[model samples]
Target: MRVEYINPFVEAAYNILREVMHGEIKRGELYLKSTSMPVLGVAAIIGLAGDVQGRVLVDMTKDTAIKVASTMLEGMEMEPLTHLNDMGKATITELANMITGQAVTKLHNLGFKFDLTPPAIFTGDNMEIADTGVEALIVPMILEHGKIEINVAIRERN
Candidate 1:
């Protein structure tokens, strides 16, 4: 894994988690996982092109996701958030899109230009959302606030 390839993600995550998620993330950490998830949660995937060729996935459980989503929507429960529902999917997808959008600008500022495909939302407990042929660098970010965790996965283009 390349540090150059990964640092931007950390930068982006910290910014988004702080600015949008109502999360006060620390310096933040990144990880790679080859294991299968018990559930897919909400996967907001933005395809990559140009300087960086990879997809970024912001995934989370329904409950944890609702908490973050509601927080983003001004600290109110969504009223009817259920497992993998459309509301949950939209919430997570938008969050991922916002992060990626900011990342694009940051990358541009740093002298790299990358284009993103539209963010896609997937909802399922047992579905797999991996780019079959791309090498992935999973960046699992953790947020703390009376016990909450938010994980993000990023993989370069296939």
Candidate 2:
């Protein structure tokens, strides 16, 4: 909800993505969603709790996921994936974790204490996410492989 909260995630996503993909990373305009919104096929979600509570979703199409995963794997000198298999899913999940971990570190330095759940990957044909009472702020990062949306929905705990 707060711009203060969103900036770190956006910065982290940009920094990590640029480093990992080893390509230009373009950030799109920020947008808000308060109602149910469709996901782009594959999503990696991380839950946050402590001073702030909610979740962050790294969302993208399956094709994009495959491309991203392949790029990441290639960087590690591992075989690139042709599809969203177990290794591909794990690669995406780790990407989400790295982004969240960096963002959380920044937030912690700013005095926001929180814990993050392990990243979870969800893939399907048609998927929608609705977070009651919390508005989600989405930052779209466009890469050579494809686009990934970093969706942040968090608020101070009562």
Candidate 3:
């Protein structure tokens, strides 16, 4: 992965977390392999195409997800993830969507135009994305209230 692409995502994450959850996110090493499956809690996956093609998975544990949703809903605590309701999915998906939309716009000004598909939220341990030919950039975010990770499974076309 290019240092260029990685930095943009980092900056994007910082902005998104600060705006969405009103919290600071500390980033860590990449979880590059598929062995990292059975991801915890809720996950939102958005596919990107056009100039960049790959899958972006944003995940957070159920507790943190609820905390985030609560924060988004204007300082109200949500019911636990055991409920597994639509509102939770909407909040998480919207968060992922917002992050991707901002990132795409930034990339456009840099001469890269990428199209992002609608985000889908998955629960439990069965969700997966087929492996892509190119190496994917994995970013792990640790937030005070939750986790926000972005998997940039896209590579620049030759």
Tell me each candidate's TM-score.
0.73, 0.98, 0.82
Runs in model 1 lying further than 4 Å from the true structure: 23-28, 34-39, 75-87, 144-158
Per residue, candidate 1 scores C-alpha lDDT tens digits across 17-108 of 87765545665344555555434455667777885566677766656776666666564443644344566667778878877787677767
Instruction: Using lDDT, rank the candidates from best to worst.
Output: 2, 3, 1
Write the residue-wise lDDT of candidate 3 on 20-136 in tens digits.
Answer: 676566888865664345466688988888865677778777777877776776645545444447887798899888887777777887878788888898877555555646665
Best-fitting candidate, measured by lDDT?
Answer: 2
Residue-pair clashes, model 1? 3
Worst 10 residues of 3 by lDDT: 75-84
Error at 113, model 1, angstroms: 2.0
> Could you tell me which 10 consecutive residues in candidate 1 have the lowest summed lDDT?
145-154
lDDT of 2 by residue, 1-158 (tens): 87678889999999999888977889999999999999999999999998889999999999999999999999999999988999999999999999999999998998889899989999998899999999999999998878899999998887
Which consecutive 10 residues in model 2 have the weakest lDDT in total? 1-10
Clashing pairs in 1: 53-157, 54-156, 54-157
lDDT of 3 at 60: 72
* Better by lDDT, candidate 2 or 1: 2
TM-score for candidate 2 = 0.98
